[model samples]
Target chain A: MDIIVCVKQVPDTTDVKIDPKTGTLIREGVPSIVNPDDKHAIEEALRLKEKHGGKVTVLSMGPPQAGDALREASAMGADDMILLCDRAFAGADTWATSYTLGEAAKKIGYDLIICGREAIDGDTAQIGPQMAEHLELPQITYVRKVDVDNGKIICERALEDGYERVEANLPALLTVISDVNKPRYPSVRGIVEAYQEKEITTWTAADIQADEKCIGLDGSPTSVKKSFAPEPKGEGEILEGTTNEVCKQLVAKLMDKNVVR
Target chain B: MEFALNKEQEMIRKTAREFAENEIGPIAAEIDETTEFPKDTVKKLGELGFMGMTVPKEYGGAGMDDVSYAIAVEEISRVCASHGVTMSVNNSLVCWPLQKYGTEEQKQKYLIPLANGEKLGCFGLTEPNAGTDAGSQTTVARKEGDKYIINGSKVFITNASQSQTAIIFAMTDKSKGTRGISTFVVDTDTPGFSIGTIEQKMGIRGSVQAELVFENMEIPQENLLGKEGRGFGLAMATLDGGRIGIASQALGIAQAAYEESVKYAKEREQFGKPIAKFQAIQWFIADMATEIDAARLMVYKAAFDKWQGKPYTVSAAMAKFFASDIAMNATRNAIQIHGGYGYTKEYPVERFYRDAKITEIYEGTTEVQKMVIAGNLLK
Candidate 1:
């Protein structure tokens, strides 16, 4: 089983700064980290490899600096790392990113594909499903639990109130959530081996045979008009009385605003 | 002239810091209060390839450098000195000597497990009568055919109660003085081998310190570490590396104390504003930060010298004494900065103060370290 994991490097800080004029992230001076969910995805891939016996390869489509994220995945026991680094892949939105990653996946070949449910920096939650569509492979998104055996995969998809169990054949993609499993820290030996011994295979848009028109800024369809923190709403009224009375008051106030039917 | 850690070393440091903060930090105070060995975390450290960090890969170690090992010890000690010392004794005192001096069979039987963290190992050299004067150790091992009958006891042995294996130094030929000491690998489960009194400690209570009694304890002749009568040299060589670990431990303690003091100074208010606004508090923080940075560099340099295969005896001694002195001073100032709260158990500075004292005493006293450095200069 050759499992390929898609990862993204995002600014380490939670208070992400945006360029007011450009309507893009102000990334200078900020440290980068493998997106939290992407790390969980890598950990799951390694866990599956350990159980099913196969190579785990981590793939990312970002700048050359993204190689650091790939190396970190390798340190977490991934067998191979691939960084799709090219100036042609810059300014990519989720759509172009997925298209490029999907093309790289097709070139690498995989029995299983795993992606994070979402990157913290880009909370669109579209790349995994979009990539699945590009490859025409079945996908289980928001996956909290997984069981793979006999060339089949079973996953528990977390929903609003409960969960939905889905089964798929081999050669499937899964977008894992944090609840899937607690990730393991990279051991000291693993870190040394990753940097000293392992080679991170770099791929370009041309190398993956990606459509040039469908990559980078030219490829992205959606552009942010503006991004800013929303102002806090006015203070709320405190309802006092029994629980039922408070609930009635709340519903009456919500109805007055037509917030809910 | 480069002060930065390499990529590998940086990764190791990051991993150790994360592990120390998340896994060990929460339990440090609890374990210290209970005096219960952090068995689970120690096992986790083994899985993280920290137990035998500096040992070679073929022997089930992480095959890391001495600086990386020191960084790891520092991080662990920053959160919990007990765990730090446990890891230090294993890597520096036990695994190092075995890898350097043990025969193929010895490596196979003992080094592998100890390095892999499957079994714990302790070094036995200090006796009740011999502390700084290690040359006067009265424990004797009489050679009898294929076996040695060891009839003496070692006191203040770390990990003694829990260890499965020990590197025991006994006077095989007392008539020859310190040169008569021979090193042997003795199984703690051997007949007539027993753990004596477990000492109640002032600090690092999470780690056990006990007396090891050997009454006619039989050790296999093949278990001898290096040639006969060479134990003293081996022990000294081992301490040279061990001091690096102790220095790192002290550096970590100082770092913790300094950080705590800074935090308290900023949050604690005495006058119209935070205590940090005062010049007195500012000076303490300044002095602590300076000392900690210097001590860290000294510890790292000692570790680097050892890694470069340089003669590190005097350097290790220098690092040990300097870092430990800094640790004591830093913790003292940390308590002073925190005022009454720092003296209480609520703050970890008091614990740091207690733990720092041991670093100045164990491995070698500050006076002993000075003697080592001066002795070299004089010679």
Candidate 2:
């Protein structure tokens, strides 16, 4: 089995800042970390590799620096890593980003593909499904449980009310939530080995054979017209006096505003 | 002139960060609150090859570089300081000594099991009467024919109760003071060997700390580590590497605290605006970030030096001192930034604040680190 785990390098949201004038995210000096949910996805891939005995490759599309995420995957027991990085991939919305990643996955040719349910910064919940559409493959999103046997992928999707179980054929995409499995710490030795042995394979848009018109800001359809801080709501007026008086006043206020039927 | 981390180092940082965030972060408070050692998690770490970071692959270790070891320590410490110490003790205190000084038979017997995480190990150096004054240790070892009879007690030993093996320092020749001290690898199952009471600590409570008593504990001559009079030097060398782990641990704790504070500042509202919009809060965030970055650089430099097999004692001391102090300060600022909410245990920053103080005291005290640095400068 060949599994490809999609990862992203995002500014540690904890350190993210907003540009006051442009209302854009200020990324400078913020440390970049692998997306939290993606870690669960990688762990799932690793578990699959261990049980099924196959290669696990990690793929990421971002700036050149995103190679860090790939290398990280390698250290955490991924067999291989590829970074689909280029200036052309910058500022892409979820649709364009998913399309490019899907294309890269197609080029890699994997039996399974996995990704985080959503990136913390975007919170779009669109990338995995959109990638599945682009690749024309079945997708199981918000997957909390996954098991592979008899050439079939069985998963439980977390829904609002409860969960839905689905089984798919080979060559599928899974968007994992953080509750899937606990990711393992890199051993002292694994860290050293990763430090000494792993190299991230970097690919540009040309390398992935991506269409120029389908990437970056130019390829993205949605653009923010304006971004500003949320407006504050007014504080509630306190009703003072005896409990009965306060209750009466509150009722009268509600009646005056026609809040009570 | 390449200042950037190579692919492997980069991967180590990434993997550790991910693991810390996904596995260790959520449970840190619970474990700290319960004072329970994360045994299952530690076992998982061992299976992942974390137990013997610097030990050679031949010894069942991952045989990674010093940078990786430091990075792992930093990452684990970022989420849980107790786990970080467990890793450090295994890598720096237990495995490193065996690799450097143990004979082939001893290495096979001790290092392999320890590196494989099949067994837990600890170092017995600090005692009730001796800490910074390690040479003043009163544990005595008397040679009797083919065996040595050891009698003494070690206190405040991390991982002591749960550990299967311990490398203990005992004096063979009382007249020679430090030079008379020698190290011996002791199996916990040996007769007359018993673990004393577990210490109630202020922080890193998830790691077990206890007293080890060796009363007429007999061990074969083959258990000796290195030369007869090299225990002091061996202990010092082990601590040099250990300090790097401690520095990284401190860096992790501080980084986590700073990150939590930043997140809270941005989301928390006051006076019709996010608190982050206020200059006072922004300044606190800025200082925390700057300090954490500086501490990270210092720790990395020390780790890099250790990787290169250079003399990193002074650098390690400096890194440990600075990083631990920064951790304390960063957690303090994180609490202040959160205001009343920070005071409550409902938030993680309060736990971080409680956890950070111990970093300055253990591995080496701040005063001790300054002394080490100054002594190196003078030399």
Strongest candidate by DockQ: 1
lDDT of 2 by residue, B1-379 (tens): 5568766666666667766778777888888888888888888778777788778899988877787788889888888988999999998999999999999999999999999888899999998888989999899999999889999999989999889999999999999999999999999999989999889987887889999999999999999999887899899999988999888888988988898888999899999999999999989989999999899888988988988888899999999999999999999999999998999988888877777887788777999999999998998
i-RMS of candidate 1: 0.7
TM-score of chain A of each: 0.85, 0.84
Q: For model 2, name the residue pairs that clash.
A: A187-B49, A187-B50, A188-B50, A188-B53, A189-B53, A192-B64, A192-B65, A195-B8
Residue B152 deviation, candidate 1, in Å? Answer: 0.7
Docking class of 1: medium
Candidate 1 residue-wise lDDT, B1-379, digit = tens: 7998887887888789989999999999998899998889998998888999988989989889999999999999999999999999999999999999999999989998998889899999999999899999799999999989999899999999989999989999999998999999988999989999999999999998999999998888999999999999999899999999999999999999988998888898776799999999999989999988888889999999999999899999999999999999999999999888999999999999999999999999999999999999999
Model number with the top lDDT: 1
